[model samples]
Target: MKRSEQNVVARSSLPWNHSCGSKSFAATMSTKAEIPHFVDFFKESHWSKKKDDWLDHKCMEKHGELENLRTMCSQPDAIPMSQEEMSVAVLGKKSGYLRGYGVGRKPCNTNTTSRDNGEEVIILREELSSLKELNDTQQQQLEAQNEQLAIQQQQIKAQNQKLEKFQEVLLRCGLLSSDECGEESTEGG
Candidate 1:
């Protein structure tokens, strides 16, 4: 065989096949592993656009019901409840349901808590602190802007008063009376 044809055969017979196959499989398995267990909870059910519409309808109904409950509770005759009782009534005993399904769980404490799979808790306290600082800065800016607006209003009021005084002086001096001023100047001349 020619040198080019021999090179092609050598390349085709390389161990790249085994390495590539294993790497691809490992990548696929890792991706699948990252999916939350809650996704499988609804897998058996047919997920269609209609299901999403139904969920939206249910959410609206629940919101309306909560609003009605709030109005009722605000009445003078309504019974008062403690915070714990209110929480129990609103959230029920299934508070850990999300954690059970591996969805929306609170971030694990880096200092003490440990996940079964040994994943490190991603600490974002520094990021959160920076965000809070940004919010405070924004609030300060808004307050400063309000104070500046008030100062501008006072300045505008002062300017208006000064303009009124100037007009009054002009009127008192008879300078505002064009015809009278003209006739007086003509008689003097």
Candidate 2:
């Protein structure tokens, strides 16, 4: 293994001080442009008190892969983002803290592998087409619900008409008075 890799491995094995005075590895390294290895951060003081769980073991096994991804993302050819975008990505937009305030203003690097412009456009078009199809399906479902609502309204109107007819018939047969049928007698004395 390379000297730096060996150093990182050695650091990962070291016991971390979890006292109040101790700053987290993430807090210390946040300002630096280089992304630290996952093992370096997670293996340190944070969860040292707990048993080495399955998740920790799994993450440790894949730390190298995570480091590789970080390296790829931080490459010079990666896409540039606005300060606001970087802040949102790092702190999350919903967080109450102002942009680039809580953490040191280290911007996240975006991974942008080379792709043909035409191919990229085609991929975006395909995604847009899929979204349109989803919107159309939702619209169709809404229209169906509206149609059902209209049909229900018509059915209720018909039922009300039948009930009115029944009430009129009962009134004529003397089984129901105008008061009993919830109607005022219109005839004047």
Candidate 3:
């Protein structure tokens, strides 16, 4: 069989092979400017933008084959893109492609601002909890300090009462002479 006929047959039979088969064909057709219809068909297919890295690799490999075919056919100007250009284009387009059909979900209106707001809420909750804990600790310390102050005040009151009784005894025993007591009273006054 001719090489071209063999390639066509192989491509046709690929539907029964595996999921990677369609991707491989798409990649193979990507380099051929002469086969724009096939290229468009592959690009528009739902399976083209799947998240399967193995399939992507196989597709890339088949694209290399298309380049080889172009080289063999001596149609240098028919090349779709230079290696550098293709790489840049592929990288640039991949994000959009994945976001569109590759992710298999409807694109929502979520943005970076919403994500930042979520993080801010979490931070604020943590800060509030910490402040509450600090306030509780301060209240406990204040209670402890107030208890200590009460104990000290009771000690001072007892000491004052003892001093007053000792002074009365001294005066009653006459240990302080009248003149001395008189002087003491004057000093006390």
Candidate 4:
């Protein structure tokens, strides 16, 4: 691994230090126009975002990603914002690894259409589970119904054979005449 990557690993593995103060979040863009490695970012962070939405100047400054640069540059806005307020706004706008944006922000999280994508995933999983359960039940019922129909068919076949034998015996004993054995019955004048 590169020295910078090793440093990152070291920092991550090191125990938490209360005195170490705040964390430094990496900005999507760096000064001097360094080519953004979006694919690399996503691969490393395991989060995806569009190329256009990767960078936002306000968010960079708010999240302290541009803090070092900010110290050297003049304040862009005259309105002084409280640290707490800035932190809250930044948190609300920032997502894990990927950037967060407020209302009217362009390129909103691709994962969500009108609601939380995470919630949508959960709901879909539940619906799928219910559908699977229903399918299993229907399949079981179908098998049972088929078995019952087969048994009924067998019983009917046996009853038909028994009735044929009984008719044949009656005919042989002259109890039922040939005309009564399903032949056309015509009355003599």
Specify the highest-lDDT model's number: 2
Tens-place lDDT per residue, model 1, 1-189, is: 999999899867642222222333324334663632221222211123545532334334433444455566668999744322332344343454331122233355322336522432234666678889999999999999999999999998887677666656777887677565555446643
lDDT of 4 at 179: 70
* Clash pairs for candidate 4: 93-100
Candidate 1 or 4, higher TM-score? 4
Comparing 2 and 4 on lDDT, the stronger one: 2
Model 3 per-residue lDDT at 166: 72
Q: Which stretches of candidate 2 lie over 4 Å from their true place?
A: 1-120, 183-189
All candidates: TM-score? 0.32, 0.38, 0.37, 0.39
lDDT of each: 0.48, 0.55, 0.53, 0.49
Residue 100 CA displacement from its true place in model 1, Å: 25
lDDT of 4 by residue, 2-56 (tens): 9999989986774221111242223332321663343232222222244533233
lDDT of 3 by residue, 141-161 (tens): 999999999999998888767
> Which segments of model 1 are wrong by more than 4 Å?
1-122, 177-189
The TM-score of predicted model 2 comes to 0.38
Residue 83 deviation, candidate 2, in Å?
19
Task: Kindly report which residue stretches of model 3 are placed more than 4 angstroms away from their true locations once superposed.
Answer: 1-110, 176-189
Error of 2 at 84 (Å): 20
